[model samples]
Target: MNVNPVELHEVSFAYNGTEVLRQVTLTVRPGEFLAVIGPNGGGKTTLLKIILGLLRPSEGTVTVLGTDPVSARAQIGYVPQRSAHERDFPISVWDTVLMGRLGRRAFRLSYHSDDEDAAREALRAVEMLDYQDRQIGRLSEGQRQRVFVARALAGRPRLLLMDEPTASVDVVMQAGIYQLLQKIKQDLTIVLVTHDIGVIASYVDKIACLGGEMFYHDSKEIGQKDLEKMYDCPVELIAHGVPHRVVREHRHD
Candidate 1:
């Protein structure tokens, strides 16, 4: 039987005596591409961290791939939010991608041939194999993002979690990144945290609006009421006359 890729029941997390998440329950099924959207400081990253086993919830249970997050971490690939200084790192793309295979190998002396093959296949999947030898710092933001994705894929994860993967790229590059994801979504379950509501409807299979609480309609379509509750204000989801009505316009009488 196929197990759910992620399951969290009444999950709550707090940092430094302040609660960031409160009784948020969610389930991501196999082969699902779910996007988590919410305002800043709304525990979006915290949720991802908890799911990755990097942080333990203060309350409730968390399960990933039919097991605890830490036990199932080997099958999970994570692409964290990009940092400004990361672009200046003195590492080659090939080396960066190989880092994903760090804990998966037999001996820690050096990377095995299997690791090299995985890294190569991952670079090819992201269409970055030609630039594998190049310095990571020399690539464009979009290209760098692709390399990071390749690094994640090198681990051969069944569940992929991305945190704001396209935050720094231009509009066109953003589309390209989404298109790449579309090609790979058939093989992996994806959970992405994004503020780019305008493009999510076209790509993701479902939408989860998360604030301190979880407001999910169990479909890609999100109602105006859900958006309002997520943002804690009236939201106008006008996307320059785009037909996708993720959140309806707020009209004044």
Candidate 2:
């Protein structure tokens, strides 16, 4: 039997007595692209933080790779969604990609041949290898997102966690980023927290619709009914392929 890469047992959390996650139990198979979709303040980010050891569960245990997140920190890579538009932070695309290998690189300081090879491969995977010398600030929103992904890829992660990677980019760039995610998903177990349910239908393996309650549903057969229950509004189904999505008055909730 294949062991689950992530296991959350009876996990519960809260901030100042308001419950965030209650008795939340979940498991992720190795190399599964599980997207966590939910409304605001629904504990989506909290769940990722718990899995990453950034937040401790108030009621249960989380085992990542058979160990606590703190102990297995190096096994997972995270690409957080944040704008790189701040001024005066000097970082190159090459350096940003290199940062992902820092855990192992910390011991070596000098990157070995294999490290360079992996970085190059990851950059190539994201189609940004040629722009290695460009300053991160100089790149467009899409390019910067790819660079961040390249950084996460450098970690050689068994599992990758991302949050709203396309939120900062435009509509055209969002599609490109989703396609890039599709390619990368084949290599690692990906857990993405996103609000765009439409863009997700083609790439992600499964949809975990989080609402007033947490619901993990199949990506296939996601019709108007499934969406209405999740969003509590009328919706229309739009099919592209395996990842079908809903078109509602309010799509993102």
Candidate 3:
């Protein structure tokens, strides 16, 4: 039997005296593409940070790859919500991706040929090899996002975590990014956090609707009531072709 790539049991978190997550339990099986959708400040980013071991839960147990998140962090690739550095900084796409290999090194002496090979392979996987020499700032938002994915893939991780990857990209480019993720998910487990409910349903295998609590389903067939409960308001799901979008009904009180 295959072990799950991520498992959370009764996980809860708090800041100061306020609670953020409450009794959240989730399991991500190997090679599964799971999307965590929720409103802003709904603990989606917190959950990803917990899985990355950047923050510890206030309560419950978290296991990643059958080990503690911190212990297994090196085996996990992460694409955060935003890049730390300036986007317009003059940096080659290849160099940016090569940085992913830094975690595998003990010192920053120099990159080896193997590192270059891995970076190139990751770029090719994302169809960004031709842009390797291009300055990252010169590319469109979608292209930059793909380069970020390539950077994460350069680590050769078994699990990939992306936080709002397409937030900065155009709507037209979003589909392509999800398609790329679908292709890559065949080889690794993926956990993506996004608010774009419409485009995700067609790409991900499962959905975990998170607010302060979480409702997980094996498929994207979530009920309207459940969505209302998750968002704490009346919600409607609009279906267009293969994608579905969620719209919360406005109430003037």
Instruction: List per-prediction Cα lDDT, in the order shown.
Output: 0.88, 0.79, 0.87
Q: Please give the lDDT score for candidate 1.
A: 0.88
lDDT of 2 by residue, 20-108 (tens): 88887787888788888766677888888989999988898899988889887787888886854542369888878888888877876
Best by TM-score: 1
Give candidates' CA RMSD values in order: 2.2, 3.2, 2.5
**Candidate 2 or 1, higher TM-score:** 1
| Candidate 1 worst ten-residue window by lDDT | 238-247
Query: By summed lDDT, which 10 consecutive residues of candidate 3 come out lowest?
Result: 238-247
The sequence of per-residue lDDT tens digits that candidate 3 reaches over residues 146-177 is 99999999999999999999897888899999
Candidate 1: count of backbone clashes, pairs at least 3 residues apart or interchain: 0
Task: Give the clash count for each candidate.
Answer: 0, 1, 1
Candidate 2: regions farther than 4 A off: 84-88, 221-239, 243-253
Q: Model 2: which residue pairs collide?
A: 201-243
* Alpha-carbon lDDT of model 3: 0.87
TM-score of 3: 0.92
Per-model TM-score on C-alpha atoms: 0.94, 0.87, 0.92
